[model samples]
Target chain A: MSGSDASATTLGEASERETLKRIFPRLPESRSTIVGPGDDAAVLAAPDGRYVVTTDMMVHGPDFRWAWSAPYDLGWKAAATNLSDVAAMGAVPTALVVAIAAPASTPVSDLEELADGLRDGCAALAPGCGVVGGDLSVSDTFTIAVTAFGDLEGRAPVLRSGARVGDVVAVSGMLGAAATGLRLLFSEAVDAAGEPDRARFERVLAAHPETVTAQLRPRPPIADGPLAAQAGATAMLDLSDGLALDARRVAEASGVGIDLDPGLLGDDVEIALTGGEDHGLFAAFPAGAGLPGGFRAIGVVVPGAGVLVGGRPFDERGGWDPYIGWDGHGG
Target chain B: MSGSDASATTLGEASERETLKRIFPRLPESRSTIVGPGDDAAVLAAPDGRYVVTTDMMVHGPDFRWAWSAPYDLGWKAAATNLSDVAAMGAVPTALVVAIAAPASTPVSDLEELADGLRDGCAALAPGCGVVGGDLSVSDTFTIAVTAFGDLEGRAPVLRSGARVGDVVAVSGMLGAAATGLRLLFSEAVDAAGEPDRARFERVLAAHPETVTAQLRPRPPIADGPLAAQAGATAMLDLSDGLALDARRVAEASGVGIDLDPGLLGDDVEIALTGGEDHGLFAAFPAGAGLPGGFRAIGVVVPGAGVLVGGRPFDERGGWDPYIGWDGHGG
Candidate 1:
């Protein structure tokens, strides 16, 4: 790239229209878009007479660090996380409207890469799903807020309150990998003084690609969400805040209890039980109903009020909570 | 409220769930909400088989100042701005998904008041439209990102590119009050050092309630949007970035020129022509079609490429461009 190109130019030096002109070409238009970006709002087809919507925010420091996450990774993770929520509702994501607020000194190229990542993430995870519209603003802190829309295709939404006692508890997608990746970044990817070092971070990522990738750019089982719902999932939710805490939420919402089998979760049972940000689908199905192809039975619903591990109560809330969990560390 | 209540507690001192518990009661449920908050995603009805979607971001610095606006005003303006975009598309807003990222030190009661503002903004401007879902996170910059969904009720969306050479230009709602209010804020509602002063802002606001309220908590004519479309408006857009710049946008999009009659605008024609953030509906109607009730004719469309005032080409682009206009001052 030349000195005047996007890589060298900061957003502060560019007009909002000029920046948008650069981004519009990289973004993919959704199949359902009647009128895409550039207008006041994008018009999208809601073929089933109803749509599922979800919004999520990822802010610097509490959500991710510039030392660890690339602009592309941030965009991909934003798309993946919101798409997972739509899937948890048994809906196919149709469109996304993303609003990014970054420091004016941010490179215009960074936003271009983010747009590419959003396009690629949608194309890979949910074909035909694309970014239909978005907004940009200057802020002191970088924040990405995404609202995803999903098509239910005439199916009734599978809610978290539907799980019944005697239903088999199951999950799709890796559970412990993302949390393990975060631990690796914090422990092995930092310098001697506990700051993130690019060299050390790259070394750790190279050594544990799967676990680290799970943290940086997760590929949730988006398709399996609708499949589980189609197969009569009684209740479902995205396992964003660790299996233990999220399962307890389902139990509490459903007026039932869940009993998990540690042996079913991989070799690192503790990590699988308490780790979060996997964005996997956790669901309940009738005992006789066959579980979906990607899902494996990990537990059973029981008559009670909370979660259980081998018939004993597991009450420790081991999941991410921004206010309580973030240590005020940027890197 | 007691100190132990939301008034004194900061977000960092409360869990995400605890904060949500306090906010949920203050929010109103949309009439079309199939599933509201607490679910992984919200389900909303799209009775017209299509939806108009838009997203807008307001960061603390370029958008508002703490000295001038309360949390309630921020929330109300956020809703009003996004709702106006939906209305400009000739659609009735059905739902809103708001994402707020604020500093951890922000008091919880500020957020509760913000939620009340969102509720009331919806109730007063567009009845039956409510906050269907939202996300919250911790950030150094207070940012509000809102995604609005609107139902067309089967009418074709009025696009900015639909204007013809002979159309009459019209506007609904106050023109220069918001920008005039902002000018007053910048010039008089600040201390000698050019910093916003709370007491000075309140004094200025009390002296000019209509103008200051136009800036702090805009009440855009949301109902006029659908009415214009029903009455045969050719092109429409929300007058967000001043009459001159936004009209130029419509003119350029439509391959025509708009000529405004300064006599029709109120006194202070420069402010009326160049002021922004009123979020009013600006539209073009056939000369033969009777203008909508709230709308008043202000100009005429002519064959050309930009905006004009009294047959003279108005070349200066006067509008709020965060990147180019903000002086990097938060307050």
Candidate 2:
């Protein structure tokens, strides 16, 4: 079936072309999208002679709960997580291509709203970015898998293994904000709401919404990444799986140790150390270099073989393992 | 848990790092992977100053059947589908990034086998291409979403919207093989096998394996796409959704109509016109432009609205409609 073949009453079973017409105009148009959605593939400008590519997928039941998140929030989070990886690479995200798997029973309006959120997320957070292409399919479960391509603007990518000993460690944005938001969403006050969904969602948002928003719609320090890279940061990565675990990753990759000072993170010290999904940029730079405005010192890179918090060994690896349920079901 | 923090007893519940360690070696490495899997994002060389990117996903039930397709075939098909899109755009595939979501209960060996399949697929089908990066997540249903990045080598993309009315329509490979393969897989003889799965698969393979292979792991005319583009093809697309329907797409996009000659399709005229998943390169060239070696004229672009079969308007829309189900399960 074609786009023009659909009638007003036949919107529920609209052809893929028809559905795409509704989505195309809503997506932001960016200069990087040399060939946008509608073709077999999209041609995007690489600009600096290289492409920084990353992908992340969110599945229903595990990645989001419809009882809490709207379709729009899911779309925003999907774009946010992938874009943050590009940012962590010290590149400016240019375009996104999403492949969505859904059951045919899904409402057309829901998909449209999701596309709107995808466009809005890029515009409000990573300006000059847009969704370039997409593919749709029917499946038993709902899933949104997004791939983002970025341009480095002629600068070299900041890899996690580039850290050197004596480099001052810094993070752009709050650590563990998403972990705090997840905990809040599961609290008795939020889970025990007896009202209908709309009223409950509004009420939930009315209470400590900023933290909840961090979990549902993360606005990572995207622009700050390139600025830090330009300012001579040697190594970088996004705090997707908490500072402790991810910091250990960089330390291991760079063949060094890290001395983490949780106290420097203020009141959310523990969360800052162990919380995942923060999407903050963690980097290492020469000790005396001027820091980007969004960054604050978290610790220093050391010449050793382990991660030390407050100069002492830390045991808790409380970061999320996607395969393991909170109740230890799958694990 | 960190990469070195896992023990023999805890392998089943091993941390993400350990699981990734097993996956990393299984993925094929390429020179284009400036920064590979262990980084925040993979950096691939885009020497042409631009990149051609496309994505596709395969689900457990809808896209493949575990009983019919081995892990290797699934990997091959996933890679083939996305790479074909790059080929359709007249580009050489440089790298692939795969995101796999599967239940934690899945065996470690199975994941390794899947990764091996992915590597083998790249080595055998798309030489010089490799899996550069990936993300692993947990989900009840298994899904593999792959993104392929390509280098245009400074050539203009062959778009579906560029076909001219007088262009000759051509195809680079067989049509309807996958559709026929699907029919055979559903046959009673294959369904009634009492032998072990390995023996049964061999027996099935002994009976016209090429057709089944077409459905499971299509070897699309990848190199021929660029060849046709270089040979002055006016428009191009991969024969993914079938000839008649996809031809209609090109005609619609270019404001022309396609006149298909079913008799010229050799033996499987019906399949040639309607079979989905052929993955052949379909192109339109100037009336007398020298055709690529692999291409043969199958029709002609006409000056009209809808697709015509042998000079008559054809009503059957046999292309795959993703929203509709084979057994009416979803729509």
Candidate 3:
């Protein structure tokens, strides 16, 4: 069938031969790819002699819901999630491979929409880094797993083990927006009725439109990571967990103490310290190093143990623990 | 708890955090990795460079069955499946990250065993490689997804489009063993209540124990891929979708025809033509180039179209098609 004329409904039922004929030509070819999709595996070139890799999985229920997320959003989220990992490493994302599992009954239109979303996300976050290859399988529920790769270009990999005493702690991008967005989505403010809670969801829309969008679709600070690394940042990481817990991690990894400046947090101290899912970058700079663009100094590393928020010992009373759920007030 | 005193029952959950701690001591000091695992997103070292990457997924029901496969086997298979792709590109396997989804009730011991399996698989298949990172989530069924990275060592990648009409088709490792082994495992003879079917299963098992193991745990010829590239193989690929289909892929990509000599099958035409899950290296060599070690001449490139078996056209009827099921045949 012609590319534009091919219907999504027929993509799965058509034999593997036909699928190959239709899909193979649409993919782009690059000199860095020795082998592209269609083989058992695609072969890629790692010019830097070292490669950085990461993976993430999005399940239909736990990670996303179809009623709330469009197929394109699902695709975009899948790519964005893994890209955040690669970006968090201060690496430049070069390519991605995705494995998608959905029910046989899933409309082909949905799949195409998902692909479109993936293309959009990659284009926005990582130019020239497209979906190089992927596998499609039939499953009872929809699942999307994406893997991303980056090149260090012969520079030493900025590992989590490099923080030292006297380092300056800093962050880039907004924190807690995604977390608050999620809270708004799940709260009683959104009713679970017509169109899968659109009415109640509207309340969330009315309350914090930007935060809700952030929660629904996180846009990782892809460039800020590398920028921080280049700016003499001594230690760096992505803020996925709450600030306090993640700060503790940096302290432990760097074998130093972390003291956060509560005065700097303004009104969102609780959300800033306890929030999760903000794909922002946090780095520890050498003493006296100026912060880079999009970054703000937030704390300092000292010769002690654990993390202290606003000079007070931080506890697990706030933030998120997978088993304990959210610990912030009203959460 | 002491390493020796660690209880197997608590191995999965209790040790996960501890293992992260243990790895801290072995990590290299890098400024790019500002934050590590304890945080939501890891800070990584991204030097100023481009990146190359790929991803794959393994579902419980479609890829492996726990009834006959152990947790360790599943882990090894998952890692191997992704690593093969990295290797196929003439790249040295570097780091890997995994995302797993499984039932909450899954035994802790099973999860630990799976982790051990991943470690063993990476060590054996791609030395110096580490699991590096991962995510764990609860799901109704088991799913494993791995993303792998590789270093190209400055060599130009061997693309599928470089094959010439006179190229020789060569392969490394055995074919059809996995497919045949799977057949024996799923047949009525193996799980049937009757004596006759049981006898048939026993006969097949006795005759092809290696085949059964091959299906259960495929060992991809990872090293051969790079070797073939270094040896100047015009085009190369990994054999996963059966010989005929995969060979056709090479032909289509190179814009040439391939002719297989059935007589060269050496008494296992069924396995050579219709086998799946071999994960072997298939390369097209210059007409006069010597076959690399571990590779055998199986076919030749011709000046026509598609793949021909014994001078005759081959169809998908004899091979594995996930949509059509196994159909109780050679595939």
Query: Which model scores highest in lDDT?
Result: 1
TM-score of each: 0.98, 0.92, 0.84
Runs off by more than 4 Å, candidate 2: A1-12, A189-204, A326-331, B1-12, B187-205, B326-331
What is the fnat of candidate 2? 0.74
The lDDT of each candidate is 0.92, 0.82, 0.68
* Local accuracy of candidate 2 as per-residue lDDT tens digits, A160-274: 8889999999999878888888776665224343322445556666787888899888899889888888998999999998889889889888999899886787797888889
Mind giving the per-residue lDDT tens digits that candidate 1 earns over B19-45? 989998998679889999999999999
Q: How far off is residue B162 in model 3, in Å?
A: 3.0
CAPRI-wise, candidate 2 is medium
Better of 1 and 3 by DockQ: 1
Per-residue lDDT for A249-309 in model 3, tens only?
7788778889989877657888988888777777888889888868888888888888898
Q: Which residue pairs show collisions in model 1? A: none
What is the alpha-carbon lDDT of model 2 when measured against the actual structure? 0.82
After superposition, the stretches of candidate 3 with alpha carbons farther than 4 Å from their true spots are: A1-48, A153-156, A164-166, A189-199, A317-331, B1-53, B152-154, B189-207, B323-331
**Taking the tens digit of each residue's C-alpha lDDT, what string does model 3 give over B1-331?**
3446543433234433554444333422222332334433443432322223457777766677675567888888777777777666666666666777765455656776777777778777777555656676555557787766555555556666678988889888787888878877776334444222435555666678798768766788777767787888888877777888788878888999899988876578877788888877778999989887688898899998888988887765455655444111111
Write down the DockQ of candidate 3. 0.26
Best by DockQ: 1
